[model samples]
Target chain A: MSTWNMITFQDSNSLYSDNLISFHDFIMLFIIMIISLTLFFIVDLMLNKFMNLLLLKNHMIEIIWTLIPMFILMMICYPSLKILYFIDEMFNPYFSIKAIGHQWYWSYEYPEFNNYEINCYMNNYMNKNQFRLLETDNRLIIPFKISLRLLVSSVDVIHSWTIQSLGIKVDAVPGRINQLNLFSIRPGLFFGQCSEICGINHSFMPIMLESTSYFNFINWMNNNNN
Target chain B: MVKYTQLGNATTLETPADLKPKTAPYDPRFPNQNQTRYCYTSYLDFHRCKKRHSEEYEACKYFKKVYTAMCPLAWTTNWDEQIENGNFPGDI
Candidate 1:
């Protein structure tokens, strides 16, 4: 899959994920790789005797190299810390959903809405139009452009609830509740799978979410109650 | 005089290997008496069969039988209701 294209991260659906990708591209394209390539070229020129470096033993060069690396590290660290805090930061969400991981399936609960829940299982034999193992019987529905909190845990072994496009990965460990915030930028279907190696049928656990408009979400809620 | 004997012989000493007993493979036709495992596996199989033969319910009769036999009636009924109402039962 990586070879077909560069296997770039999926087109991000959330602002947080988009920011993360942009930061990644900035570091790789502008800072790290660019500097590394420039250094390599300089080294190559030095080796070819095209560029003479007579200040090899100079204290100024030593100080400059050490200070420059420190400066570069600090630059990288600032944004890294900001993003980490941004991800951890939680706001008042419209609703919360609890996801409990089983051995080979996932169970989602909407606690705010009268204990509404659903078990999502992978569709083993998919139709020609559906993704092979990505399709699930039930989708975790959320409204677009709204802050939603997800509480993750496990009933059996450890399972990681990962949604690559949304840049959310929380380990679903037994007796431990992990929380993450989700804000969908648009209405669409996103697919993910249980990242943790759970059991014999671990690969069968797939996660699918359908983001809808606020009005449609209310309609869905009303429909479910009836 | 004490008889002197070699305490450790590299060739004579045999190390015991760490061994684990192999488990039997799961058989849908003759499932184990454990209802939990049997029902869970049957539930998966039922869905798998249903997905594979969407147009033909007769083809998945074996899975349906296994699931129906293994899973409790209450659980099956609840799940059937949930499916009917577009709500998936969280428990099998």
Candidate 2:
């Protein structure tokens, strides 16, 4: 029996994969961090060193400092805008999942699979011996190496479906369906939870996704067929 | 809430007086009764069990017992795995 403190390592074939958008986002963050850190020290040192060298009564230095930040902001915004447009440009999706958020849980439907649907709720016990809230009764399994489209929405209130490994987070708003794309490079289990506060059991709406090879996925789907 | 006795088992809620059926010999194995059922606690706990076991049906009885021991809302589990796999004698 596994002890409470022992962490179960993930299987060898993991699901994580690199994507262009995430790489760009990381680069942008890195640039912003470097600029902020350097500017912070530079500004502090300059303020002390040149306190009396520059004009004391004029406010031009403050204006220059303000415009410099605005210029940096433009540099950050342009790339972010371009990436948003790129992600929004759609193409043919291999498979789609309809996730409907409810009061205390989430329900998912696969229209291709005879409209099969299942409700998922969270189990929050943290005794490593027990499954934590990260696990769900019926995981939304998908095939690896294929782009999967997710249609997210809500039935009662607003919620957000977010998975850190996939780097995808979208709002589940009532009366609106938002779509996102995901493709795992390999086979493994990915866990997520409700990122938005909807109701009393907002913390209970956990999501579990299992990705497998195309052949294994088809076999698993056939086995789970109604 | 009024309690009802069916097959020597006392239920939490009473049966509707107008819909009462004729009394018959009490069977310990299967007790047929009409009563208000509480399902919330049972459903959530069974859901917890499915997550822990990844939908393995052999542990349904053990999970059901755990659910009942915890609270009255232990009725939400569909027990589909056990029904799909079929229950066998001496199976836990």
Candidate 3:
């Protein structure tokens, strides 16, 4: 049995979770920036009081504030650009799934598995027992500990496929395909909703992904086909 | 295995609040199944839903069939309940 660690951001059963070094790096940089900005503000406040004294007549505080922010911005920009490029670079994937977005629903296709396809649409009118907008007829099932490539596209309008737990979010454009690298850590259910406002029913486009062991995943794929 | 949501009593299913509305097709007064005539030029809204006319239904049916063949298990709809609820099958 695997122990669950909430302190870590690593997903339950994934390989690309290790590749998420850039996101963490940017987060650390962001924290440093906040601290630097806070200190700069404090120093500016002190210097403002000090400058009130006619004896010390220098434009030093203004220069420091301008230069410090520029330095901080440069620091933030470099890592931000690097992370964007790294995420865009597509590595060889173990498996791929094509996700299609409609007005208020999502459809998925596994081309490699005899074109096994699944349509997962949210049921808005959940009878007394069902989850509203968050419930779908079919859930996306993937294996833990494998690199999965997601190809996202839309049929009608633009939408965003986002699943924070897996740290995956990609845009679904009408005529173009957007690719995303996703991998999950463990065998459990995780949920997310459409990040973009596509239509009135946009809120109804909920996503449910379940990660399982490689063997169990294979069994699921087979069962789905049968 | 599928279940509906229970009300505050936690034992009864919450029926739709509007037991019947003006849009209810079950009302015999408007049995012709009235729908708005939507012009393509005027229909560019976010939730713009296109309704095919009788003549266009043939082409729409072909497209639906092709789509279903492309993705079999995903296209089927529950017809009986949908009909009772005044919802069109394969509308999307």
lDDT of 2 by residue, A145-199 (tens): 5665566777679998876566567888765556665656567877778999888
Candidate 3 predicts chain B with a TM-score of 0.24
Model 3: residue B2 alpha-carbon error in angstroms: 42
List where candidate 2 sits over 4 angstroms from the true fold: A1-71, A124-127, B1-92
Give TM-scores of the second chain, every candidate: 0.50, 0.25, 0.24
For all candidates in order, the CA lDDT equals 0.68, 0.56, 0.57
Give each model's clash number: 0, 8, 18
Task: Indicate the TM-score of model 3.
Answer: 0.57
TM-score of chain A of 1: 0.88
- Across residues B1-92, which tens digit of lDDT does each residue of candidate 3 receive? 11111111111222234322111012132122111111111112111222434324555444333223222132223333564477743333
Ranking by TM-score: 1, 3, 2
Which ranges of candidate 1 are over 4 A from the true structure? A1-6, A30-56, B1-92
Clash list (residue pairs), candidate 2:
B40-B73, B41-B73, B41-B74, B42-B73, B42-B74, B42-B75, B43-B75, B43-B76
True contacts kept of 2: 0.00
Whole-structure CA lDDT of model 2: 0.56
